[model samples]
Target chain A: MKMDVIQPFINSADAVLAQGLECSTAIGSLSMEEEAYRRKGVAAMVWLTGDIEGRIIIDLDPETAVRVASKMAGAELPESDSLVRETACELANQIIGNAITALNDQGFHFRVHPPVMHMSEEGIKSSEDTEALVMCFETPIGSVFMNIALRYNRKRHADAASAGH
Target chain B: MEQFAPVKRSKDGQPVRYLIVDDSVFARKNLARMVESFGGHLAGEAGDGLTAITEYDRTHPDIVLMDITMPQMEGIEAAERIVQSHPDARIVMVSSVGYQENIVAALQRGARHFVQKPVKPEVLYEVIKYVLGDDGAVATAAGAGV
Candidate 1:
């Protein structure tokens, strides 16, 4: 994926964590993985269309999910509670919402579906040829895992579009 | 420093009733906390747009804080339906999707105002006051958090 696409998600996640949760987050090491992503305790998927045809996956363990939810709720909640799961989804939604705003400001028109939660045992399996950019953030609550995997190989088109059309 | 005086009571001595509609419990609870802090009562709560419509009929709240993305029906649709049935319904769109299209659509559908999610207390307070025509509390939201 292009830096333009990946950087916004990273910046937005940082902003959302700091502004929304009042917690400063530090960026962990980054890695590129070309493998199927097995969903952990909770995963939120935001599908993108228009200029970007792919999805952004945010995964967190139950402990991290509970901590994040508790902070957002201003009260502690058990991992089994439905509200915890909703909080996970909302976090992803807000982060992507911010990212979309940045992308749109850069003249990239992309529409995102409402963030959806996946809790089934079966995890998300990326296509074999897809290269996923995995970025990790260490927050006061816990670690946040973001995977940016694009199915479209439209780098040239995106590059031309970014050239101030 | 400007302190928020308690809402005390409305000029008519009646409590301002609010119905909060959101799919997230965190959102509902947080907004409810804000309402109570401002001396308003949460008349009811709905997790989706469909329930919002039914709850609107039953609760008849003075104001509605609606979330745009929901499973059954979108917030705009619900606002339209409520406005169709009761033209005086005071509905506000509170959403994370701050996209222009969605915001414009909600405003066109009879929503009195729009406030993006991750809402600050002062912004919400200002919006609710403005929508309810409470000019006394209609100060600019900026610098009020201090």
Candidate 2:
């Protein structure tokens, strides 16, 4: 069966790009999405619940990460790592929150798990030995990758109301 | 985030429906917001990989938004299981698990997309569009279905 799922994320992206950012800039078309993640980079992830569950990975390099951090921190330019992480954390918070709102409208409500920053060099462990999906994008800064995995065998909507997700 | 029912449709030769998955309460709220804007519907959702599998069985999500770390079932483990169960399953690793190394590990684990935190909506949407082959749109997704 086919399903309608694009509108949610699209709207969220548009809203975040235009409204959430302090100074929105042109991200442009992933010109070379083919090479979206040829090299390593920085990535952020969050989990989904209710109706559907998985992960959301936002990948970017240090350069782009720093630039995004600068804007997120309301800075004309960045010089400190703490400043960048703060902005990045906030930026992640807003974007991820908006994404959840978008999905919620789709009849799939789920609360976020939290935002974690990784350098990509650290190995990401797994539940089992198998493959996964990597949804990659080309940002003006560098590349953004959103990876996903299989749904394990467990109960359903155990905590649907408390989280409002 | 508001609660709504997921929309179901007939795929024109479609094999899988990718799901946006994560563990953070804040992140999930944000993601649900984005999904609602898409077409007012979602296949299913889960907190960890373990539960995700159950949800996946019901909805059979093709692609997934996977976080690298979490309680109970981590994204990587979930990815492996989902992929192992369904080879065609597209699991996108959505976490800031690292830069280069995790990306490769995710790829090896059957992950198709790898992104970092502080997600950009456009970037995320692009991954969904590319992976899902530009199919389906969830609108306000009015009427609670959850």
Candidate 3:
């Protein structure tokens, strides 16, 4: 049976936009669905390990992605700037951290290695048989997908995620 | 007064009611668009600290997302005031590490969580559930909660 793992991710993303950033949203927009999807321009990729072995690639269009990236970078993105990729990686890192905590409350645990965010329409190749979960978010330039990949061989730990004791 | 729409809940029975605040209109609209996907209600909305404070007082939101920096009463200031009044205010501060100063200031002001830009819905939802607890049900759907 499929654990409703993605539910927590979507909640984390909405919280990030609604509560984490402004007394409101600072900028940007999002949508949700299931499927391996793609968009034009840049994508932010964050790797995952531990109980769940997989990678989450959050892909976005350059223009909209850049606006999001610039906020994290604390500067405005120049027209056609190259930093979109870097920003996407950082965004992925934040999303992972937040999502893990939400999952932890549900008796889940995992260790995330250092994330390497970058861009690629094709993205870092995953093994063909690897199970993947992809979620797409829409923005001005286009849509971006947040992909969660997991391998079954990893030892799954259902422990307390953090220090809530 | 505009009536708030009903929100959904997780199998665990957590109601997602969100209060979104940001100076940028674009960001606000973006968040408003898909808040329901996370099973979250638009508890209320605000553009700055003063507005945040006012809304927080009225709505007593389950989550408060404030940007580290903005025009007129920044997020840090808003968080401090929210915490001061509602010591239990669940505030998750937002900023790119590029603005370490803002992030630091917000932490000092008593934010419970942190998220970066691009504001993915799943990422935000996860943190809110973690911090606010599974008690997050919409006020309107009290009977419908799990």
Q: Which numbered prediction scores highest in DockQ against the true structure?
A: 1
TM-score of chain B of each: 0.86, 0.75, 0.77
Expressed as tens digits, the lDDT of each residue in B66-112 for candidate 2 is 77666688778888888888897877777743345556878898888
Write one digit per residue (lDDT tens) for candidate 3, span A5-86.
6666666655554443332332244333234445445665555555556766666666766666444333465645446555
Give per-residue CA lDDT, model 3, range B44-145, as digits (tens).
888777899999999987777776445577677889999999998889875432234445667788988887665655676667667766556433455555
Q: What docking tier does model 2 reach?
A: incorrect
- Report every candidate's CA lDDT: 0.78, 0.54, 0.60
Tens-digit lDDT string for candidate 1 (A34-82) = 7666675678888887777777888888788878877766667677756
Ranking by lDDT: 1, 3, 2
Error of 3 at B77 (Å): 30
TM-score of each model, paired residue for residue: 0.83, 0.43, 0.43
Measured by TM-score, the strongest candidate is: 1
Q: Please tell me the TM-score of chain A for candidate 2.
A: 0.60
How far is B29's C-alpha from truth in model 2 (Å)? 1.8
Residue B96 displacement in candidate 1 (angstroms):
1.2
Model 3 lDDT at residue A35: 41
Candidate 2 recovers a fraction of native contacts equal to 0.02
